[model samples]
Target: MSKAVIEFTDFSFTYRAQQEPTLRGINLSIREGEKVLIVGPSGSGKSTLAHCINGLIPFYYPGETAGSLRIMGQEQQEQSIAALSQTVGTVLQDPDGQFVGLTVGEDIAFVLENAAVPLQEMKERVTAAARAAGIGDLLSASPQELSGGQKQKTMLAGVLAGNVDILLFDEPLASLDPFTGTRTIEHIDRLQRETGKTVIIIEHRLEEVLHRPVDRIIIMNDGVIACDLPPAELLSSGLLAGTGLREPLYLTALRYAGVAVTPDLQPQHPELIRLEGAAQRLEQWVDGYREQSGPAEAVPLLELKEVTFGYERETAVLDKLSLTVNRGEMLAIAGRNGAGKSTVSKLICGFYKPSSGSIWLNGRDIGRDTIKERAERIGFVMQNPNHMLSKTLLYDEVAFGLKLRDVPEELIRERVHGVLRICGLHAFREWPISALSYGQKKRVTIASILVLEPEIIILDEPTAGQDYRHYNEMMEFLRGLSSRGITVIMITHDMHLMLEYAQRAIVLADGKKAGDDRPERILTDRSIVEKANLRETSLYTLALRAGLQQPEELVRTFIAFDREVRRR
Candidate 1:
């Protein structure tokens, strides 16, 4: 048996700025060469635990520590941050914040350069790390110029070059497409196997992280360890259902089909699991399922005609793209990173003008509208809340837009309070923005826009980095907005979110529309899914493995059933 490299006994931590303890009475051990996943809802103390391990708990985030904690059998308080960093290397959630060097190679070699390693040795180590990370060709490219996935790879190579025994990834899949997330998990698995290093991943996307094998999963809830077990055991125990973490889609499908999931069946991998009579049960469920009526014929509210745009004169980001969005519709814009998903949203918001075409809104040309003018009718919420929030208090932040419009003080107060309640932020109205979690901050930004009461709202990756409960809450709120005749456009890479919430999906690839259809159809179509860097959901894989003749139909039926269940 491998020795425990990380151990905690009766551990607890309280930040200097907080009154209550963030991590409480935690007892845990992680063995060397083990790959483990830690997950929980926001403010569940998972991040605090990670900070403790990476020497940031006391060194960076000044905090009070209690009980005992050890790294590699040595007391944690005895080591400096720089010394702990040599043994533990972390890849942050936002890779952009970690970049220091101009080029990929320089970034990877930054640590070695600081250590005064020989020039030849640094080059050899950097090259080897880049090749291992599958970014050898990008050595000369600027880190800022790379795609989301490429930036993550560069961060991984930089950590790998440090030759740390333990690797930690913080929300590694938050910014990646479904296909790229799977590939990243595969790469992490390969590295752990080849190097015999301990791996720890802290993420909310449970399904994506389970793509590769894991030794165990640790569930954190309210400043304590809730459960710790192996993958198969944990899935079979049904503990995840109440923890606000989503089970793998295929496993959920099995339950929906009346199949009892057991550990002996190996529930971790859908393709390998054995489900006796599952096919017949699923078929019966589908046969008994009645399809809901489609929406009334769409009334075009916004249209783009042969729009062409390019950041550089020689290279086009969007090429003669044309599409129409219906009034009171919920639309999903999806594609791989750097595939012009956000560019389309920007063009609609009047941030950039098309080079050769026009945009029409409600039968009127919007080509000459200023960005401020467009903001009155079209609201855009960025992926990062930090970029949008300016006020210190939550109430002030939400009221900023209304105040800017010279609304009466009484009217602004009523509108701000109403929007806050809808966003589930009324309780924290007077709290400082810095005290809120990442998910809560995101809601504040949305509330700021909701006060404006725009006709159409565009959210870029709204559910990214959020737990299952928070994700459901946000989508349900958006669904309510759509029911009231508000149009919503979400730029996303989450296939499951697209399947669950999006009424129509527009797929972009190489600056052109690749497919426009219902989310289930878009996800199941092999050619379109592959071309747009999306993988078929595991539910589809379950159908194919069961030899179902109509896999797409099964996917559609399952989505309908899942939505109905959630509605209750």
Candidate 2:
């Protein structure tokens, strides 16, 4: 008999905030030692369901839940969250949000101390957890000092210290870079293998998470248990798309080639060959990217020539690096955490001056320019939206930049309203910044800059923490800007986002340039993928693994060509 680690029997829940229940008649059974992937779209009750399992339902969130839930053979109601801690451990979205200790070591030791474990034993436990999370060197470092990926690992260390049998991972890889994300996945896998723990991963980055060897894939939609199947079965099903989930890019690609259930099950190599040829055709058919001379036509609206800079002249974050962003270009900068993508933006904004190399603006060196001087021309948006909102109200926040520039009040109002509409924040322009969702706050940041009418915009991971809908809206807005001759430079870890939004990609590895090319070309290059510690996109990998000839083409019904075919 299989041990049911987490069993939800016709469970239902209603939040105090909403008239309708968030979770309706949910029935799920996760067996011991099984690796399960919970896939869902935004607002799909995934977080709610996860909270319920880990004892956050009645304890933290106000709600009425019916039916029986068993965690570690104990009814969920029978055990307190503290008691349940012995059975299940949870790692949340923002690892930094969960930090309680000042140092990483202290953080990992927290649960042990909470459980009243002896000092000597707690020390051993903390050491093991830190080792497992791959942050042994960061023990004394403050959790505040860690990168997004490092913070997540530190949180995992905290959870691992509890020595629980079931682990709950909620969007663990969302903020992680390709290398760190994969490493985290590997650690999770190894931890499960060694300890025989049941791991439940709730993630929206399905393609990456599901690519692993999971026992089953459980899908949630509209607060309902839509499907429970093996990973292969879920991969082969079109239900993900049908349920309004953004299916993995690979699955989307295969579907494009007209490969339905059968072709997916037993991939057709000949069709893949055709698909590859088709991909090449798409590249060749890129009529819009006509050959331009020098780096000038390559000449971006913003140019950095041999730029190098540092804070106080010790260690340069950027080592004399040079880059260019053409007018109307969407350029993506990718690298592991702390690889200077953000610093590059700061350099362009003149927040820090180059020690040696010159930065060119419209072919003129602006290396010694002030941030204010650069700001008049370029807009730099940081990752954290809250930090950027200067005013209390959305309308005021959007208009803040232009107001600082001393634009006429009438013009500021007019342009702010226009940009709010374009950025999809018009309805909430009068609302307080405190009332804004993370996605909404992010859009407000973009609008704040857009109203300034900067010729070049640099966004640092614009799509971070966003759902597919928000992601699409943000990218679509950026696309419109690019069309109007604004050069969009994004520092991001999302390979798919780069592939779709950016016309060109520049990869920085080990603090230097590894690639500068179209995303299609960059992604197809194995050397680049290897150097960056990125796994192939699921569709690309599936096509490769399944021995397809034109894997990329057959993957999407080949969207671009299909659209062309439709138009023809």
Q: Give each model a TM-score.
A: 0.98, 0.84
- Report model 1's TM-score to 2 decimal places: 0.98
Q: Count the backbone clashes (under 3 Å) in each candidate.
A: 0, 17
Q: What is the lDDT of candidate 2?
A: 0.76
Compared with the true structure, what per-residue lDDT tens digits does model 1 show for residues 1-568? 9999999999999999888999999999999999999999877899889999999879988989999999998999999988888889999888888999999999999999988999999999999999999999999999999988999999999989999989999999988988898999999999999999999999998888888999999999999999999999999998898888899989988888888899998999887888677888888877788867666578999999999999999999999999999988999999998899999999999988898899999999999999999999999999888899999999999999988899999999999998888777888899999978777898889889878889999999998777888788778988888888899999999998899889899999999999999999999999999999998999899998888889988889888889889998
List the candidate 2 regions with Cα displacement exceeding 4 Å: 63-70, 73-79, 144-147, 263-299, 389-444, 447-453, 539-568
TM-score for candidate 2, please give it.
0.84
The residue ranges of model 1 lying beyond 4 angstroms of the native Cα positions read none
Best by lDDT: 1
